[model samples]
Target: MNAGALVLVVVQVAVMVVLSPLLVGVMRQVRARMEGRAGAGVLQPWRDLRKLLGKETLQADGTSWVMAAGPVVLLGSSALVCALVPLVGTTTFPLVPDDLFVVVSVLLLGTVALALVGLDAGSAFGGMGSSRHMTIAALVEPTVLVSVYALSIPVGSSALSAIVEARIADPASIASPVSLLALVALSVAVLAETGRMPVDNPSTHLELTMIHEAMVLESSGRDLAWLELGSWLRLGALLGLVGSLLVPWGIAGDVTVPALAVGVLALALKLGVIGAGLAAGEVFLAKLRLFRVPELLAGSFVLAFLAVTASYLVVQG
Candidate 1:
């Protein structure tokens, strides 16, 4: 990587580290306000992180190396996925064919690692949560992959950089019916992937309904801190990927300082809109029952399939 790329990478990573908690805080505050309560400040997640870090970590009895290593691996994988995503106009690293597939796989890897660790601790809730998590993942992953592939069709490559570059090259393509359909499908996938409402409720702590939180109930102190931060970072990364693919406007294709700054601002604006939409959706919709999740995801799959079919027809026409 060149100096400019290196700088951009470092900035993006630092931004993810700092801004992840704020993103979580924003979601929490918005959710609270929607429910008619005076919401906590956007800095609340940061405060929670600080409190967790200051506490002592306790391990479960008979927990193996896998349990201890899970959080670190999860955090590392989250960071790696964030780095691989073309968040700010261009990728810091060179584009690799089929890398987008790898990105999705890495996310699954992290999720599985956390689930295993949860089960390793011998907590009934943890094991139950892990089982539920894998079930959701098995259903959700294909929808995400197919939906993203639908969007990638017009660009003729699965590489995120290629997709972004194609969209930038022809901004009008975003208005095409196929593109619109793909965006809709991807939007649903995003909500599902991020544990948003009508799919998974981020705020729910009830063991019967909780999937993500139940797995982490045994985690404490710095370990919990890392897991929480990783979740936020993963959210931001997924949002950034969607933005890059669907709304490539105002992204800087070059590496100049001014261009980088513009890219960053544009990215922030896109994320802000996404965050608001998520907040609004959560406000309006109730969480779906665990059994109903398959139907929701299957709907996304059909939409994605239609999107791909529509794109092919439009291109051929």
Candidate 2:
């Protein structure tokens, strides 16, 4: 990659790394306020990460190397995908990494890696969480894929940069019913996939109410720090992905400094909006029964299918 491209990549990762925890904190604070209570400041997640890092490591007995390596691998995979997500730049030669297939693969890799960590822990709670997580993941993945595919139909390419470029070139495509339905499906997938409320509660530790929390019950110290930080980064990356695909505004183009700056600003604005919506959902909605989670994702899959069908009809018309 050219030095400019390398620099842009670094900037993209750095921006997400610095802002990811802040987004989580914002969501929590917003939820607290909506529930009529005082909440931690938006810097709470940063403070929590620092606390985790300074604490000592505590590895579980009988756990495999996969457990020990899982947190770093999960975080590393998330960071890798963030670099190619087109969060800042639209496209750069020698490193125009915007393949939709790669994005989905990396995301699944992170999910599976975390699942391995949970299963390797040898704890009953961990095993239970891993199984539940995988079940929902299986249902959510297809919905996510179909939603993006529906969005990319107009562009004739699954490359995120190409899709964004096409959308920018014809902004009206954003308002199509197909796009709207696909986005709705994607919203459900994001909430379920990210372990947000009404799917799984990020803040809850109740064993009966845990899906993601159960998986991480065995990690402590820096391992937990990496996992926690990675969760934040994952949320940020997903939000950025949605913004690039659906919002597609102010993204850097032509590698200009001013354009990149605007892209960063726009990216933050989009994440803020997503975080607020998440907070509101958490406050207003209750977590579903484990069996009912499938119904939620299944509904998303149907919407995604309709989105694809509608896109073909609309595009043809």
Candidate 3:
């Protein structure tokens, strides 16, 4: 990578790491306000992370190295996704083109890592959470792939940056039925992938309803810190993606100082708006039953499939 690309990647990753916790805080605050409670200030997640890092991680007997390695792997994977996705700018390494399949594969690595962590915990709750998680993943992943594939069809390439650039270059495309359908489907997939409401409530700890929380019940201190931060970062990055696709403006086309500044400001604004809106929407939503979750995901897949067919028809017409 050239110096410009390298600098852009570093900035994107740093921005993501710093803003992710705040995004989570904003979401929580929004939810709290909507629920008529005085929320902890938006800095609560950062405060929680500081406290967690200072504490020592405790390991239970019979737990293997995964208990130690899993969080690190998950965090590392999240960071990698931050680097690969076009959050700040479209400039990327020649060797790392931000291909759609590659990005999805990297995300799956974290998903599998988290699932293994849950299973390695050797607790019944952990096992149950992992099972539910995998079931959701099986349904959600295909929707993500197919939805993006529909988007990629218009660009004739799978690099996410290229797709974003194409939409920016042709803003009218963003309003097309194909784009609308694919984006909606992709948004639903993101909610499921990120453990948001109506799929798995992030704030819930009820054993019967827990999917993400159950996996980390055995982790504490720095281990838990990594898990939380990793998940937050992933959610932020994906939100940025959805924001960029929906409104592909202000993302730097060239890695110059002014453009980069605009990119950062735009990214922050987009994330905050989306986070607050998502939190508000969730307040009125109910979590679907475990069996119904698949039906919802399947419905998204059909939208994605229709989008792909529409895209091909548009091209051939």
Between prediction 1 and prediction 3, the one with superior lDDT is 3
Q: Which candidate's TM-score is highest?
A: 3
Q: Count steric clashes of candidate 2.
A: 0
Candidate 3: list runs displaced more than 4 Å: 315-317
TM-score, structure 1 vs. true: 0.94
User: Using TM-score as the measure, what is the rank order of every candidate, best first?
Assistant: 3, 2, 1
lDDT of 3 by residue, 210-274 (tens): 99988988999999999999999899988999998998899998899999999999999999999
The best candidate by lDDT is 3
Better model by TM-score: candidate 1 vs candidate 2: 2
TM-score (all chains, Cα) for each model? 0.94, 0.96, 0.98
In candidate 2, what are the lDDT values of residues 1-317, reduced to their tens digit? 47777778889999999989999989989988987889989999999999999999987788878877999988988897888788887665454556878888888899999999889978889999999999998999999999989988888888877888887888888888988899889989988888997899888868877899999999999999998888888889988888776888798876778988898899999999988887886787888999999998999999999999998888533
**Local accuracy of candidate 1 as per-residue lDDT tens digits, 161-228:** 77788889888887888877877787787777767788778888688888888888888888888888
Number of colliding residue pairs in each model: 0, 0, 0
What's model 3's lDDT at 243? 93
User: lDDT of candidate 2?
Assistant: 0.86
TM-score of 2: 0.96
